[model samples]
Target: MNRSALTARGTPRRRMSVEQRREQIMDAARDLAVTEGFHAATLERIAQACGITKTLIYQQFGNLSGLLLAMVEREFARAAAGFTAARQRPPQPGQSGFAAGVAGVLEAVDAAPATWRMILLPSQGGPPELYERLDEARRLTREALVADLLAADPALASLTNPDHEAAIALLHAMSEELVRLRLSDPAAFTVERLLAQAEWLAKAMFGRRG
Candidate 1:
């Protein structure tokens, strides 16, 4: 038996690599923040959840805010990739890339509700800084979506005037509300039904041009 393998209590210590350790800590923090409140997932709680010391967590992430910011960055990157993939997918007959993009985001939420909720849902008692960061990310996403919409259907190019910002805001708001409804009541807001309604609305707004 390797003498160094066992602890003083004769229990084997799980020595994770640096990356693995960071993942474990981040996962613990995310799970706690999502399940409980963000404030509840303090550094101590995260450390405890991951069976690590608070000092180790600090060493890994510098602070609780640092850990949270990292989580936000990762989630945003994932969402951006999902949006890009949906837009790049070969368009289905009678389906615009914009519609596909919307569906892709919803599908991602279905796949990872907790992760999406962290950004989508209102953070009641979470740090104001967190909310600010999320708001900025959302703003950037909306701008990107507007660009994609114009690219997907060149007709929309004419709509980009002084009041275009308001239109984009309204469109983004509507999509977000639909997502919230789907997440809140899946039975009432089935993906098929939502997609159909969205398609209908899209046709009504833009007409069957292509």
Candidate 2:
């Protein structure tokens, strides 16, 4: 009777179980990861910041690798919604849609350099399993860009046809290049330069070239 009572009394009650708390921990880790670079994010640090024990993180997330993967996946979802899918649905038409799509990504790159930096320059050598997450979001974004361009100027639809696939490829290249430059050295280029050059590239490809 005494042993059972003692054990029961000693057992600590958790505010949130391993699973629920792990998500919270991961959420905190994600915000930190995006705020601070991935390299600076550590298990101990994240656990401490979350006000939980390190073992709880392991029990919930499986390990650093498991937690890291979850974090990357969440990041990819953000990219999908914020950069890619959103580009597909610009509220208006004409030049504004095209300009906004490009500008939106530029803003994200500036706002969350750590997020983009991880994609361009992965830390922790990266997880091989996560290889497709970024590409999937990026591919979707590229496709959205092409669709936006066509919508903005229906004239493009009538005058195409060296290759439909080529159009997709070109948009992908342009999006990637813009993101690359945005992430490369943001301070070097003014907003005007960035927008002007991007518009020029878009014009070169879709405006008159085709």
Candidate 3:
């Protein structure tokens, strides 16, 4: 028997690697941020939530700001990866690519509602850095969406004076609202309903182009 693996109390002490411990701390921080608010996700609270010492968290993340930033970046990257994978999937038969993309976004939201809520509907009192990062991500996403829209529909690109910026802004706002609604009240705002509305709008816009 490996006596070294057992605590003095005779129970086996669970050993977690540095990365595992960091993940535990980040998970606690994320849950606190989502359920309460970022203000509630203090080092003391996170340590208590994860049953760890605050000093350990400090050692792993350097400070509260670093911890928060790392947590947000991890979640954002995860959500982005999911969205990118969803977008790469082939569209269903008879479905327009735009509708398919909307469906993919909704699918990503459904997969991680908490992650989406943190990004899309951030709670007040979060650090300015958090909001700044979110703004940058949104800007990049909008730019990509604009490019995709222009490629998908030749008519949009052919316009002598296309207001793509304005159009993309409007679309982005609406999509964010729909995602927020779905996350806030999944039962009331099912993905199917939202996708149908988006598809209808896309069809209407494309119809006018013909």
Candidate 4:
């Protein structure tokens, strides 16, 4: 080939912006962490995954720990945003707010299976920061759910003497289990099926009281 033709062919088709490159690096790291454990998400491996040099990653994120931490923070923020958006949506007509919220959660999981997988079924051997972030996310989710439960069903919240704490714990556990099941076996535990069951359970529990 001619020199100019060779040069043109060798050049990248398009250049990524710094932010785009950072996102690409983070995505590669997240996929590695999800598929092969966090231990596999070293700078060299991430560079290989992104078709970039370790130096580039370092420029973007400072170091291996910085890259991983940034990736985790970005992913957690994404998942949290999804859940927040879902929660903000108004309930469908004739549907209890709780049922609507469950549907929203399933929809979020369906939209981002990889993100949900990392959160719902996190790989072992991750850094302590990862576990701490996960714990904080869980606590925040539980607190939000409790508040939603109280607001959605004033009857329950206004009971003569309700054990709101225990009820909230049970609800949180059930929601977490459902998400885990969906992540583990998506085909077997489809969103529609799970949502139907949740709705049925909710109605069964609250029908007489309503």
Return the top candidate by lDDT: 4
lDDT of 1 by residue, 64-137 (tens): 88998787676667766765665566556987655676787788878877677777774567667668877887
TM-score of 2: 0.69
Itemize residue pairs with steric clashes in candidate 3: none
lDDT of each: 0.74, 0.67, 0.80, 0.82
| Candidate order (lDDT) | 4, 3, 1, 2
Tell me the tens digit of each residue's lDDT in model 4 across 1-210: 345444455853566899999999999989998999888988889999888899999899899889888888888998999899878878878776667787888889889888888887889977778889999988998899878866887777554335668766777778788889998888999887887777775665455442
Off-target runs (Cα >4 Å) in candidate 4 are 1-12, 158-161, 204-207
Measured on C-alpha atoms, candidate 1 has an lDDT of 0.74
Clashing pairs in 4: none
Q: Write the per-residue lDDT of candidate 2 for residues 115-207, one digit (tens) a residue.
A: 666665555545675667766766766677677767776776554345656865775676667777777777776555776776666555555
Pairs in clash, predicted candidate 1: none
TM-score of each: 0.80, 0.69, 0.87, 0.88
Which sections of candidate 1 miss by over 4 Å? 1-14, 157-165, 208-210
Give residue 41's error in model 3 in angstroms: 0.6
Model 4 alpha-carbon miss at residue 203, Å: 3.5
